[model samples]
Target: MLKRLLLLLCLTGHVFAKEPPDVECLVVHLKYVHCSWNKQGTPEVNYTFYGWFVIIRDSADVSECPSYLSENNINTGCNQPCGSRFNSFYTRLVHENQSSKEKEHELKTKVKLNPPTNLTVHYGSDSNLWLSWTQISSNCVESEVRYRINNRNWAVVSIGKQNYCLNLPSHSSLYELQVRSRIGYACGLSEFWSDWTEPVVWGSNNSTDPNKMNSSMSVWTPVLSVVGAFILIVLVMMLLHNERWVICDSQTSHTCCSFLKDWFKFPEGLKEGLNYNERPCPVREYCHVRQSDSESSDCSTCSVTTDQTDCSVFIPVNESDLPTPCSSSISQF
Candidate 1:
């Protein structure tokens, strides 16, 4: 009678639960069951939560779901035992706000998470076989593996944990295997299983490849070598360019760097014209002919060969033959 009254109180309090908790429940890839709830608009000082999960299987109240809790006894989620063969689950979230009665909300639909990936069946040894997979999240704790012999109905394989190997197959045979994992939340265990990983077939003769370890290294070796060679070439070119910038471009007239600076210098033709001719000019111009200091306006010309670049030229002139001073004019052609 007390149990019946408690059940009635629990149900009657659902409307007063005040903003029913958003609830969700799912079976993950036939691995495990998960459920969670959120109490909306409830204050912490007034917030005390109580949750009850009714795990329904095959139209029967099979068991109560396990509550996942936090370090502070706060509700995280819930997990329920489920194996390869699974169908559905129902979840109810409860809240208490200063009252003996509780607020409850039940999810109308089932929720599921993504399954494990890269299911591979490898030959562990002549006598054993290995099954491997990747977890979807760190919350994932373990996998529920289901397998079959030939065309037989599936049965759960007992492996201790999901992330690591537990036990090898008792003996090698033609087998089909599939696996799925469940999450362990900071608050509690996930009450749902992710979808199953893709099935893998382990042939009796299949063996783990000995050279698989070397494959990754072999691929990286050539790539690294090429990258190293490219870097070396770039460094050499950079050094050469820096040397060009310092040597010819330096303002200091250091003798040591002069030859190299000029050798590496860009051709003068790139900026301005260059005169390569070394031959002397065939003509000359002379002006202001005068004899001695006493003869103020006398001059005579003498024929002489001189270097074309010469700045000063000397000529011997007779005083009497010199020409009288006159207004200036350009030298005659």
Candidate 2:
């Protein structure tokens, strides 16, 4: 019986010797979010419960002691309670990593402004343009908004908050505007950039017509003036002729009789009652008169009362006479 007991004790020792050492913590997977670790030990073993493990080395002088090897060590969990706090804790880690890598990274991130909504462009005075947008999200800690001209180098316009009023150099050039979310890394490696907006082309207030500056003042102005003057003359003459005559004497005076008698009467030496000499009047060469009543003689003057009246006389004048009419008239009874 004593031999069997000794053998049982030896077997127990062998089993314990084969058992693997318990790890205080283990690093499993890594991502932007939570990292996992396992604490392995017997339940009775004393455990400080360090949260995570990171590979670290000591750099102290140790000539008197054996050279210490660099080893993975477990770090204490964040002072705060666990839970969603892991997100905040992870973020802090990321920030630290970024600060360290900054020496090697070429690009830097700056949050000029938060994400803007309802972005719009407007033309300002002095032929300059302005861009305005609304702020919606402010997820970034330090943020900046960048602008590019024709998709060249990105130029940072403003930082923190959404409203940016950029004074464009010229209203004639086109522009492309976009927004991005900058985390604690290089600019290019940050979260995906927002989709590019439609191009906004600038416009000019100047007239589009090329001839507007070089057009002659007299060409159109004088033509319009002559047309207006002719209209006025015709209107005034019609108004005057429309006046009714009060005939108190032996002869009733018509509209044409007064105009003709005052201007074109024969000289006093002519016989009082002889038939008028019907010479080919020189005025006839230039002016042709048509009487309203077809039976009336073409030489007799006809009266027109309404503004709509057709002229009874047509004159063939040279282009030089366009500004004036009736430079000459023949005397007649």
Candidate 3:
């Protein structure tokens, strides 16, 4: 029974030692082929790789891996140039007294390209946006552009060229753009896509937006115009009313009419009249009469005078003392 257990253990060890590494090969940007493998359960064992192209009649022309990717001096991967011909590639991993099964690959479809470069954006005089970039791969590829407005959801567009135009773009919106590329159907088929480029930003709220300014002004312009017109109308009416009361007289120092003076009368606490008492003195008439203290007769001598000089006089007399025949003399004065 002990001998049987020893034999079984030896067989198990042999099987474990014969396990092969997992290998994979792919092409990059149509320039070279990269082959990599994962080490199987043997941490102490070292691996070496061999690869070659298959020709007509299944003839084998093998060669060692030109450049090796290693870890701890153990080969894990290799890189080689891909010539201008399409063929089946054969690869295998080998370690002393143990070799992995040969693996075959058709690399026409396993392609991946690098991201695009130098993305730029510009605003034209016609209020349009232009986005462009530089392509690093020489192969014919179709580009996809992804963009967002004002940090919103992303929108994608596919084009055959490297440049795109947006007509009549909004002045108040922000734009962000990125690009990715893949092999075109016209050149060949590829299952992989390149990585997206770095994001390019244009426009922002910090900068002045002409469209936003104009929109705000449009709401208040009409209200300001109406207020200005109302003020102008009030001023014109006041000027017309004041023009009717204005008068010029050569005889007096004041130029206002009598009706205007009444309109400008002061209140009870201020001065009373409009300077009527300050007028120049006019022509005067004088009347003279004499009477004795004795109670003898009711008649008296009366005299009247009209002056062209600066003498003036006034006298009061009772009507009963005036003789009826002398009334004509009093009437003349």
The candidate that wins on TM-score is: 3
Model 1 misplaced regions, further than 4 Å: 1-111, 138-140, 158-160, 163-172, 185-187, 204-333
Ranking by lDDT: 3, 1, 2
Tens-digit lDDT track for model 2 on 270-329?
223222323333332233333343345443243222221123446565665442222344
lDDT of each: 0.51, 0.37, 0.69
Candidates in descending TM-score order:
3, 1, 2
Question: What does candidate 3's lDDT look like per residue over 1-333, in tens digits?
Answer: 999999999988876664667878878777888888754432355667888878764787777788987777767788988753257888887888477789888877777777878789999887889998887543478899999887679999999888888777776678889998877776676788889998898877532566766887897899898887667655644664687445333335243434444554433332233333332333433332235533443333423333222324334557756423221121210
What TM value does model 3 have? 0.55
lDDT of 2 at 204: 45
Question: Alpha carbon lDDT of residue 278, candidate 1?
Answer: 34
Write model 1 residue lDDT over 25-59, tens digit each, in one string: 55544356555553342223322333333345334
lDDT of 1 at 168: 55
How many collisions per candidate?
Answer: 15, 8, 0
- The TM-score of candidate 2 is 0.24
* Candidate 3: stretches off by over 4 Å: 1-14, 39-44, 71-74, 136-139, 205-333
What 10-residue stretch in candidate 2 is worst by lDDT?
A: 99-108
